[model samples]
Every structure is written in structure tokens, then in C-alpha cells.
Target chain A: MSSSLTVERHPETRPPEQRTHRQVSTLPLVAPSVIALLLWMIVPLVMTIWFSFQRYNLLNPEAREFIGFGNFTFILSDPGFWISIGITILLVVSVLVITIGLGTLLAILFDQEFPGQGIARVLAISPFFVMPTVSALIWKNMLMHPVNGLFAQITRGLGLGAIDWFANFPLLAIIIIVSWEWLPFALLILLTAIQSLDHEQLEAAHMDGAKPLALFRFVMLPHLSRAIAVVAMIETIFFLTIFAEIFVTTGGGPGLATTNLAYYIFLKALLEFDVGGASAGGLIAVILANIVAIFLMRSVARNLDT
Target chain B: MGTLEMTRKNSRKWLWAVLGWLVACLLFFPIFWMFLTSFKTEVAAVATPPQLFFQPTLENYVEIQARADYLNYAFNSVAISVGSTILALLLAVPAAYAMSFFPTKRTKGTLMWMLSTKMLPSVGVLVPVYILCRETGLLDSRIGLIIIYTLINLPIVVWMIYSFFKEVPKEILEADRMDGASTQQELRHVLLPLALPGIASTALLSIILSWNEAFWSLNLTTADAAPLTAFIASFSSPQGLFWAKLSAASTLAIAPILIFGWFSQRQLVRGLTFGAVK
Candidate 1:
């Protein structure tokens, strides 16, 4: 937190009038963002909690009443709720593993001196920029469309029989799509982290007869632990609520196969119009995300102090 | 040394280069394929074995324009993303300015708390936001989306701008104050000019995030305010192989942001991780 420049003077050395004026000026400057965020956080949250306890359904407005923990109990007992939670964890963990695993290798690969490396890096990272809906549609139709998809063509050519990706492997299909979108993000971050690795250290390791695997194991991986942690934590928070890909691709179907927590809440709220049920589901998601957020905050907070 | 050793090293370099390009192409293939399909006839787009070389046509792009007002969706996307970015900057820049320049004991905690709010899942409040938007007559309105997008991105905007401002030397601000300049004058004339590049990159990052925001845009908007994200979602249903038009639309929807993303790739790491890595 300490800077080379000492901007803050001792209180007695500075004019009292100027100090108070500066302090007062900050309140107005900072108040708007704070107040807006406070309301944004509080209003919807309070309503979600309130509605979670009530017997509110958009279909039966007259049936609205104090339901106490009925909504929570209902959601907790539902098999679909547990299934969605499992899928959510699976999706998050799977994508995290694939992206970080491939990302580390790609980062090391792309980090080396190569012709057209700039263009290659740009192309490699391009998927990260794509809108989720667009990426999902591209995968769902063009690449995974069973008979006419590119994958089918490739498979048929190889005489291995075409695989109907979404139909046969709904969750796996989604995992692939989500990983494609995020792998570039992992690459971008890890590459930046890898670039910061000391070249002389690598040279020294090479001089000591370290093999490539040994260099990666001893030198590179340790340097990347913090960055990897950042990628995992940030990706987890986003992946837990991956709605658009599911919304556009499977519609949470093959009967809740792709219904992660976000899609589950959407189904309850919009599809079924179960206000209380969706609100209860929403709270569950919030709790799950907060667990990951705690670790992310700690890692990020460390950066702040430095 | 020896010519044999020199050739081996050169070959190894080429090997890495080729491997690097192969991986890059594999990753970029889907987008490239989408781009290629955009120009093909609908039949050719889904042809068995997939037509790599085909007579390209603008028919899909033209058909898409006629079928859906593609420009309307594009305009909505631009306006909403740009609107939200500007609004977030308006709110965040001043806040970040105050926090960075006039550091207090509570500033770090306040910043951290702001970021924690961002970690709250959007679905958690979907019901309430949906009902609230419906009740306030704001659902399907660009203003509603603009507001939501602004709030969603405000934390990162504030954080990015704060880090940027922190990098500015304090001596310049102190020098400005010695000349009897007011705080506003100090910010506008002195701090603003110094922090302009960082601010510009911050704006670019904000614009990119806002432009590609899917969750709120998908849930809240149906038609009138639907951005490209929602607009593209309309292609989800199987309507007897309209892959060509879908490709055209998808390509257009993602083109602008992808270009922006390429330009901001370096800033992305810094902005996304809230300057933690950099």
C-alpha cells in the first residue's frame, strides 16, 4: 500500500481548512457510486428474501401468502434442484480444469519465439471475445449438429460413426462449448503471467541441465500458481451462473440434463412462473457463489496490499 | 560453432512455430468457419462433408436484414453498450478519483466491498429485477438495460480507474494545489490529462463487457430493447437449417466486439483481474 511518493503530510503541517475541504469534497465524489451500488445490491436482495418466504406464484396471485420456509423446503427436496446443483459443479470444475490445463500448455507454447506469433495469439484468444449466445449457437448447430455438422463429417470420413454430441452427451457438449469460450481467457491471463517469468532464471535452469519437464515443474508452475488461482477463482464465479449457453443450446433439456443453477432459476421464474420457488433457488446460488468469492477476494486483497 | 547444431536449433524453432500456429488455428477454426459459412448459400452451409470452396454470396446477409431488422438490433447493442459504459464511467471515475487521490482508512474496504457485490450471482435477483422492471414499465426498454448494465459493470470500472489513478504521481496534484487550483480544476486540468490513456482503456474494457452482456439482456428484453445477444438467441430453435443466415447474423453480432477485444487484449488481463496480475 505504501508508495514511493509521500502524498500525505502530517495533520499539523497541512492547513486545517484545506484538509477539511478536501475531505468534504471526497464524500460527494464518492457518494454516487456507493449509493447506486447500495440500492442495486439491497433492493432486489430484500425482495428476493421476502418473496422466498411467501407462497407467491405468477399463475395464482390470490394464493400468495406467508409460506415461511415452505419454498426453501420445497426446493431443497426437489430432485431437479439437487441435479442442477450437481451439473453446476460439474460444469464449473470441468471447464476450469480444461481451460487451465490447456491454457498453461498453450501459454508456454505461444510464449516461445515463433513466426506470426502475434497473429496466432490473437486468433487463439479471439473466442474469449465472442458473445456467449453466439458461441453456443455456433457449437450447437454448425459443429455439433449430428448429421451435417463438421464433426459428423470428420467422424464419418474416419469410418468411426458420427457422434451426436448434444443428444448423446448433453453435459459434455456444454462443457466443451463453455471451455472453448473461456480457454482464451485462461490463455490471456496465463500468458501474461508466463511472460513475466524471468528469462535468466530459465537460462540458469537450462545451464544446470534441467529438462523441459523439469523446467516447467520447478520454475514455471510455481511462478504461475497465483495467476492460476486468479483464473480458477474468477472463472468459477462466472461458470456457476452460465445461463446463456444453456438457454440457447439445450433449453435445459433432454430433461434437465444441462440445467445448471442459473438455468434452473430461469426455468422456475420465467417458464413455470413460480416466484417463490425461483427466489429460493436464487438464494441457493448466491450461497454457492459466495464460497468461491471468499477465496477470490483473499487472493485479490493480497494484490492490493502489495 | 557447427552448422549441424545451428540447423537443429533453427528446425526446432520452426517446429514450435508450426505447432503454435496449428493450435491457434484449431482454436480459431469455429469463428473462421462461422465467417466462411456466412457467405455461403444455405444449402452449401450445411452440405454433407461441408463445402470448403463454394460460390460465396451476400444472400444470407441480405435475407437476414430483410427478415429481422438487423440494424435495429445492432443499434440497440451499440447504444446500450456505449450508454452503459459512459454512465458507468461518469459514476466510477469521480468515485475512483476521490478514493485514489484522497485516500482514507476506509477506501480499500469500500473498494473491496464494491467488488464483492459484483460476485453476487445475477440469477439470485432475476425474479425481483424482472418483476421490478415489469412494474416500473422499464422492461424491454433500452434505459432499463442501460441501468442494469451500468450497475453490473460499475464495480470493475471503478476498480480499473482507481488503479489507473493511483499510478499518477502525487507530485503533480500537489503542485497544482500549490497554485491555488480548486479540486475540480486539479482533476479536470491536471489529473484528467495525465490519466486519459488509462481512462480510455478503462472505457474500452467497459464497452466490451457491456456489449457482450447476455444474462440481463436475455432475461429482461424480448424485442424492442433486445441487443445482439438476445437477437442471436432467436436462432436457437431449429427452423429447418437456416445456418447460413445464422452464421451471417452471428458473425456481424460478434465482429465489432471481437475487434475491440483484440485491441484491448493486454488491458483485458489488467482490467479483468482488477490489476492484480499486472
Candidate 2:
């Protein structure tokens, strides 16, 4: 096949005209997507930055004034802003730890030979597919309701008082719900990485009298580092912007208890009509996410070569 | 002694199997419970001890259908997801084709830049985009959502299709070119047919992501263009004792995407991780 293609291409190479034509056409072929993405990325970003520096509110559209750094100062000094930043960090870190740790364990479990393996795998991954609104509602009403929830029923059956999940442990509730949605993502990726591991290396380690812990630590851990990094970075990006689950479940509170930076910005923009403050908050979010995106982009760029 | 060892091994296998099954069931229980509750009456849905065995009824489904425009929302979801996916494909195929076959100094940077846009948190520009939508009367419109979805999924689509096109042997295209086939013919006859499966799975994954996109759908659409995500979110407020109806609504919202998701599990890992895992 290679020889025939090379022989056929020998005639086509005789013409410099067609080669230049193909090269010229490359720009037009790629121009549309590149231009569109460039506009999409730049326009809103510029507008957000501009708005962040002005004292603008949607309700009072006529009262636009350039109040440089005023919105930033106000947003920075707000108690809710500090609380939201804390919640955002806590939420992202907690969910990351839970998903990665649990995901690794589940991936290893599913790697073993078992009956109904395919069916179990399918079931395990279903939650990741469920829309965020539906998952939030299911957890909020069906599984976590103070009176009618399954946990309540179980507690009642076992002679203990039912815990009102959202009321008492709002952040933990959101964490559990978000973790449920993402744990499968981590599992699927890690499982793919594990399955790609060399079996001979493991056998050799076993032959060398390495116990299960040592083998996992030396061989499996090293192999899974790339996947683990990918999972951590990707999950951080998504977790930073987790809005719908909180929107549907707690509306960001029993009292701003579950409000992350994303929801806080949403509230400032839509509910309070504070565009300037929200834009400041929005810029802050962009900066926070960029910190993580830089790492993710570097890793993905490294993969581009192979 | 041999029999004892064999029994021990068999028991251990059973133990692992049981453990696996337990975890799977625990992970899947919320969905299963929702499915079960959707078929129950309002009274039965909220019954204490969680009625596991009740006479199943489609009353909630019927009520939701009668009261709300469930089909409208479903239609919007179908139209927006399908429309945006096709649009993304039209733009992505050419760009990915060029990037894969044609070597250039800037291609890698351009690809990385596209992905970096994806990492930009939607909230960062939510205020501006919302203002733009409101100004242009794109708010609560299908076209608005289609445009957004297309832009959002374009990077991933390009990446997926580029990877697929990379797998195609350059020899085939060169051979076709030598036969005096025009560029259109080469693409029409050689590329699309060869890349059909890749394109199809990419479309599938695109549909799933667009369908479950809750943030924009919720914030942008109020009633007219609300997709199933917004529809399910409408049940957030405790209006009546509508547990069964809410369950039914949630079930309807997720059913199609859930089925599509199961089929595209492998492509999902590939797409989400940008082929890093696969």
C-alpha cells in the first residue's frame, strides 16, 4: 500500500501548481473556526474587564460611570465574597480528594474478574450521565428530604433521628452530590489507564517477591500518575463552575452556606443587578480557573505530540 | 487438602463479586429509586418507609403531560442539540481536516488556544453574554442556544475529528490526488466515508453534552425555549406535594441522554480527556 501510494504520488509531485494550491487552501479551511473562536474568546472577555472597572448596574442602566477599582475594592471587602471564596476552595478540594480517592479504589475493584462485570460497570457510570438538575433534585427530594427521604426512612428503621442533610450539612450535601456525579468520570479515566498498564511488569514484580502494597506503590502508582493528574485538573475546572446542582438543590443556601464563587457571581449579576461587582467577581473567577487551566493546557499540549 | 484450597479460592471470588455488586448498586440506587417513584401516585411517592412495592401507575406522567408542555421542552432540546451538533461538525470537519493533513507552524498553538477557551469558566463572561443576548433579543431563543452550544463544543469536535483524521493513511488521499480527482471528490469519496464512524460518535458525544447542559439553559431560558434541564429545574421550588410528578419529570428529562451516554462511554473518555486516556 505504501509503495503504490508513493509510486502514484511521483506523478502528482511533478506539478508545483497543485501543491501550492493545496497549501493556499489550508488558510481558508481553518480560517472560519479560528476567527469565530477568537471573537468568542475576546469580545466577552474585554466586555467583562471593562464592566468590572465601571460602576454599572443593570437596573440603573443610565447611571454608568467609570469607577476604576471601586467595584474591585467593594467586592474584595464584602464578607459574602470572602465566604464564597472559602466555600469555593473547600468545595473544589474536598470533591477532588473524594472523587480521586474513591475513583481509584473503584477502578481497581472493577479491574478484577467478576461476574456481571459489564453490567456493573454500566450501572456505575450512569450517574455521570444524569443531568445536573435531575441529580440535584433526586438527592434533594428523594434521597435527602428530612421527612420522606430514603436516609430518613433508614434512620427511622434503625432507631436513630433522621439527619436533614441540606439543612444541617449544606456544604457536605453538595459535596456528596457533586462527588457522585464526578466519581464515575475519575473512575472511567483511571480504569482506562490501569487497563493500559503492562501485565508483564506486574508479574515480574510479583516474581521478585513484592507484596500487593509494594507492587501497587512502585508500579501501579507510577503508571497512574498521568491519569490522576488529568483527573485532578479536569475536575478542578468543572468544580470551580458547579452552578446547577447548587442552584436547584439549596439555591446556594439555607444561608449562603453552599454558595461557591460561581453562584455568588450569578446572584450579583441576575438577582441583585450589580453588574460591576459581578464582573469583578467574574474576573476573579477567571483568574482562579486560569491557574488550573494553565496546568491542564500544558499536559494536553504534551499529549499533542504523540 | 486440595478440595479445601479450591473452596477457599471460590469463596474469595464470591466475596469480591458480592462487594462489586454492592458498590454498583449503591452508586446506581438514586437513579433506580427515581425510576421506581416515577410510576407511583403522589401519596405513594412520599409514603414513609419508601414504598418499594406499590401498584405502578402512569398518573404522574399523565398529569405532567396534561399540565406542562413537556413535549415542547423535549422538542427544543432535540432541535438545539441536533442543530448545534450539525453546525459544529460543518465548521470542525474542514478545520480538523486541514490541521491533520497540512503541516503549519501555528496549528498546534491554534489548537491549544481553542482548548484554553473551553477552560474559561462560563461565569467569567456570563454577564457580558447575557447582556449581549438581552440586547440582541437572543434571550430565550433557540438560535441563541444553538450558537452557544456550537461554539462551546467546537473545540472538542475539532480535536476528536482531528485525531480521527490523523488515523487515516495519507497514502490514500495522495493516491486519489494522483488519479486526477478534484479536492472535493477526494474529500467526498475518501475522507467522509472513512471518517463517518468517528464523526458519528463525535456527534453522539456532542448531543449528550448539549442535552445535559444545565447552566446556560437554566439562566438563559425562562419558558419559551427552556430545555429539559430548565424543565426539571422548575421543580426546585416546593409548589405542591408533587414528588411523583417531579420524579416523572426528572426521569423524562434524563432518559434519552442516559441511553446515549451508555453507548458512548468509550468515546466519552476519549473526548473528555482529549484522547489522553485512549
- Give the top-scoring candidate (TM-score): 1
lDDT of 2: 0.90
- Candidate 1 per-residue C-alpha lDDT over B1-278 given as tens digits, one digit per residue, 9 for 90 to 100: 69998999899999999999999999999999999999999889988878999999999899989989899999999999999999999999989988886777889899999999999999999999999999999999999999999999999999999988888877777778899998679878998899999889899999889988999999999999999999999998776788999999999999988998999889889889977786
Q: Residue A7 in candidate 1 has what lDDT?
A: 53
What is the model-wide C-alpha lDDT for candidate 1?
Answer: 0.92
Candidate 2: lDDT of B90? Answer: 91
lDDT by residue (tens digit), candidate 2, A1-306: 121232222324436776666777899989999998998999999999999999999899899999999999999999999999999999999999999999998998888778898899989989999999999989989889989888998998899989999989999999999999999999999998888887888989999999999988999999899999999999999999999999998988988899999999999999999999999999999999999999999888888852
Candidate 1 chain A TM-score vs. reference chain A = 0.94
| Residue B70 in candidate 2, Cα distance off native in Å | 0.7
lDDT of 1 by residue, A200-251 (tens): 9999999999999999998999999999999999999999999999989999
Q: Provide all candidates' interface root-mean-square deviations.
A: 1.5, 2.0
Clashing pairs in 1: none
